[model samples]
Target: MNKFNGNKFKMDYSQFKTEVSKRRRSAATRELTKIAYSTPHSVISLAEGMPNEETFPFTEISIKLNDGSDFVLEGNELAAALQYIPSQGFPPLLQVIREFQRKAHAPPLWDSREVLIVAGGQDGLSKALEAIIGPGDPILVQNPVYPGVNVVITPHNAELIPIEQDDYGVIPICLRKRLQEREASSLKMPKIMYINATGANPTGTVMPLERRKQIYRIACEYNFLILDDDPYHFMYFTDEAPRSFLSLDTEGRVIRLDSFSKVLSSGLRIGVITAASPLVASIELHMQSSHLHAPTLSQVILYKLLKIWGYDKMMEHFRRIRSFYKERRDLIVKVAEEHLLGIAEFSVPSAGFFLWIKVPGIEDTWKMVMQRGVTHGILVAPGAAFMADTSKPCNAIRASFAKASYKEMNVAIERLALLIKDELAKNRSILNGNT
Candidate 1:
């Protein structure tokens, strides 16, 4: 892709790549491996120093499913699983995910698009940030952003400008207004905008289709890429999912990170990045120097599981997982409303596992949640953890219902209500004393 530069044309999105990424080169042996794998069976004599599979002790790997069914990995499959594969991903697994993404996202530039398998969603997100953000670069992030993203951004010394969000997720007007204001300011314009699109972390608010379209339109106008970090895509409580930024990205300005963590086993550490070919290639080069590739064993297992389940069955499994979390969402909301009805306020989460609650009297949830709530034998994420500026106070708290039982949730909320009241009374007393 080329952009008009006055009279001449220059590389367009290539500007999004940082100096660090531009300097990164694929490992020599890893590059050879790609060629070796692609050549005809008769052409491979021996170039790279790959280990002999005969020395591997494992003969087979047998996995038992919850339904008493099982699958065995042996012979050639076991050998491939035991060895290091291409940085892009194991071919078979990559094909399956591409098919899934096509069906799921229907990215507009499918032919020019590429998918790279990553160790996890966080790994993909971190690498993507590293590939683009240079020192002192300006980056736009959703307010109360994911802490993992903050960890990545901090090391780069990137200036994070927060975009305000509401029940429908990021407010389009707020984003547009911020950009308009930024034009007159001395701050450098941002090249990337990070968003958690579906079932956003901490808040559990999903961006509506219209809002996603609006955001994408703004990205096009501003000439910035949208980093759609959608780990909770399958965990949505709605009957149908809103259109993704990728689906609406006609200009290939959306770089989406999809994860198997929420709907599948997080421990497996499997994620995928779908973007334009060059962007995916740059990230793949970074992978070559880091962890060679996502765990081959995990990829093989996931590949086998998906093959046995097929596309239709896999989707059925997703529906079942959604139903399970939906039930939990209902329980948590009911309990919270019953206990903290008037003392505090919260929007019932439309997706994800968290309930973002606001306690009007509490100036900062750090003390209430980290100190008091912990003492009460209740555990919840403090809202400060998600803020762009952690030094500042946050009025909200994040309570997750993913693991707690109905009784435990009830007890937690009940205890939380007491904590809120106690804090409120103490604040009132302090104000009265000052006066």
Candidate 2:
């Protein structure tokens, strides 16, 4: 060992710096270094990564306190909102979310599961993907899955084997068949199975209890983990609440993503991941390095809401929210039945924002959306967007009733019906010409 300045420790600037992996370095590194640590008082700078005070607009925000008095957010607290805080989150808020999770799932005490606050479900999922998946690793997904999820898996260069889904969500036989087939392939079998489960994206089919049990069994049999992405869990129209995979996971093989985007407000961007503590710790380390943490301000805001509302009051709030969505679901279904039902069959949509409708004659939605949806002033999400392979055939379209006004929903279905008619007419002409 060599020492400088005749001491045990030597100040070698080069030695002080440890090497970062090539993967850890990104295009952002250069951009982050371009900013000044302390701006001059005379020269006002606007290159910071925060919104302007005028844009923030709110000096004081208030929420009802426990006894119904207003709890105001301003002064130093407001400043804290603008400043950075803990990477885990605001300390008190993390505890609040922990309480919420315990009440929501009631997972066994011995299980050693925990929650990590995230920007949203997508953020939590991305971290999970990074933790569990890598190049050439195979991940199982429900076919006709959420396209965003498909996109997430793409950069990893991981193999995606899709399990088929019926009205009740993923079919057991299809899952088994795919697993068995993959077993024979030279490629590595899928080590993780992902599903939207509650109010599945696009399809809006809630995975029934028995189906979930069957899915858990399959995961056990295959010795794989389950990534249950259930954003619409609280939005269920059914009388009883759906059980989460976290509740069923005895051996800690499931990682669940829950979101407040739908239940609370989309802009809030607060989400939670409940999984075995070990997995949560791994994902947390990723969060610490990447995002550092979800916005501390948002977590503090959510904490106030939860504290004032409490568990029972929060449940009441959720009930009203669920009821509102149920009404929209009913109206949208009625509109579809009146105009587009015969032309395009769709599931009743027991939960979630969208109705996944299939047009019998159409082979793909890209053309259908172009010719009918746009021309008729009814924009739709092509089912192909949700497919694992976008090039695969997609006859379905996803229409969300959440943001659409009642009149828009009604008129949109009428336009869809007309579009279907045109496609049918074209098909008939082709058949006649062939004859």
**C-alpha root-mean-square deviation, each candidate:** 3.4, 9.0
lDDT of candidate 2 over 140-218, digit per residue (tens): 8998788767677788787888888888898998999888887777557666788998889989988888889999999
Best by TM-score: 1
Q: Give me the runs in candidate 2 sitting further than 4 Å from their true place.
A: 1-59, 63-70
Q: Tens-digit lDDT track for model 1 on 1-435?
A: 111112111237579999989998878888887777677988954778889999999999999987577999999989999998889898899899989999987877587788899999999999999999999999999998999888998988899999899998889999999999989786688999999978899899988898888888898888899899998888899867768888887887888999898878999999999988778888999999999899999999999998888898888888888999999999999998899988989998888889999988788989878878878888888889999899899999899999988899999999988888888888998989953
Q: By TM-score, how accurate is candidate 2?
A: 0.84
Top-scoring candidate (lDDT): 1
Q: What does the lDDT come to for candidate 1?
A: 0.87
Candidate 1 minimal-lDDT segment of 10 residues: 1-10
